[model samples]
Target: VFIGLGVPLYQGYGLTETSPVVSVNTVEHNIPSSIGRPLQGVEVKIGESDELLVKGDSVMMGYWQDDEATRRVINDDGWLHTGDKARIEDGFIFITGRLKDIIVMANGEKVAPVDMEHAILEETLFEQVLVVGEARPHLAALAVLNQKEWEKFAADNNFQDAEKHSEQVEQAILERISDALHEFPGYAQIYQLGIVDEPWTVENDLLTSTLKMRRNKIQDTYQDLIESLYKK
Candidate 1:
């Protein structure tokens, strides 16, 4: 939305337990940016703590005969507890982030790093970004620059050997990221940026086969860089 890409897109939110779809923005009754109202016969509500809950026929009866496992997710009332965090306004659902991925800063500020990471990726300069500041003062990110785009950036800036690390290159990358984050609030802005030398891959154990990042692994691999980001 920041760059006005002109793509007619609609976002939806759901979990596998909800038959994979609970709320989706459709062309007929679309709220451009919202996850739209609940589907017909599907009821959705944000629990007291802001967790999204859904109940309806579309929801699975149980986890394929595993009552013990099913009971853990579906309450006696039959509401499916989607692990996602969200808010409902005027019947539309707006997902914030995953409950588990929330980061709490030292000053009691809460930030969702995924939101920041996604906004930065919209610039297409970074292929991967993991925002981290749990229990720290401010937000920091481990970013893997898109090699092709980085090379173009280097060429445009009259630099050589773009693959090699340089302070000037880092600053240039940060500038692009900063521009991409113009819509984020001050507290959510990235305070420090760490350029990751290698792209995350399943072979490197940084990513799962499904392509999800292994957060713990990345943190362990970049422990020193993470510490340097917050050095006095």
Candidate 2:
């Protein structure tokens, strides 16, 4: 086993139009959360829409024989529209979430689901939190627990009653979600949460074949569960 000691290796990002690497994370100084700094020959900038744009030699000359496609991404100034949303802090870039998946509330406050997902996963027991409340006023989440931990807790308590076990599970999930994210701002807090019996999977069409989440599919399938959780 390669027992390497580090939080991050390097931040690397690329655009197809750019034939070469745009941004690469530094191996020596690893930034845990950020994607790392831009590469030597790359120039990175963020537009008002928060989309990360790159202008560099690494950029592709243009779309392959597709003038229309080339024009949309690469402007006359030779910047590639990366179509990625990123946050720059302390001279480092961090990909918060996808621009398409970004959620903007009624009050105009923006929330990236991955940012809150990271917050929820701070606790080891926090298996997953599908940050919902898209187009709504505030944020909410559908949290799933580590089933093995939940089962072990139930067994340790010697609680054979099904009703009591269910109650304990709900209480435990809620308490952990609340305490796990105490450091977050109020709007970012999980206003409410619900639990799921099964984990997300591709077999049920809730995830991609590679195991990445298919957010829209999951949201549609669990619409009622999510709605009920937010109703309270």
Q: Which residue runs does candidate 1 get wrong by more than 4 Å?
A: 1-41, 55-80, 87-96, 162-164
Candidate-wise lDDT, in order: 0.84, 0.74
117-214: candidate 1 lDDT, tens digit per residue: 88888987789999999999888889998889878877998878754467677677778878988988788878778888799999999999999889
What lDDT is reached at residue 92 by model 1?
A: 91
Task: Tell me each candidate's TM-score.
Answer: 0.73, 0.77
Q: List the residue pairs that clash in candidate 2.
A: 10-25, 11-25, 11-35, 17-60, 18-59, 18-60
The residue-by-residue lDDT of candidate 2 on 133-199, one tens digit each, is 7778777777666767666666876655364326455665667777877877777666666767678
Model 2 root-mean-square deviation: 3.7
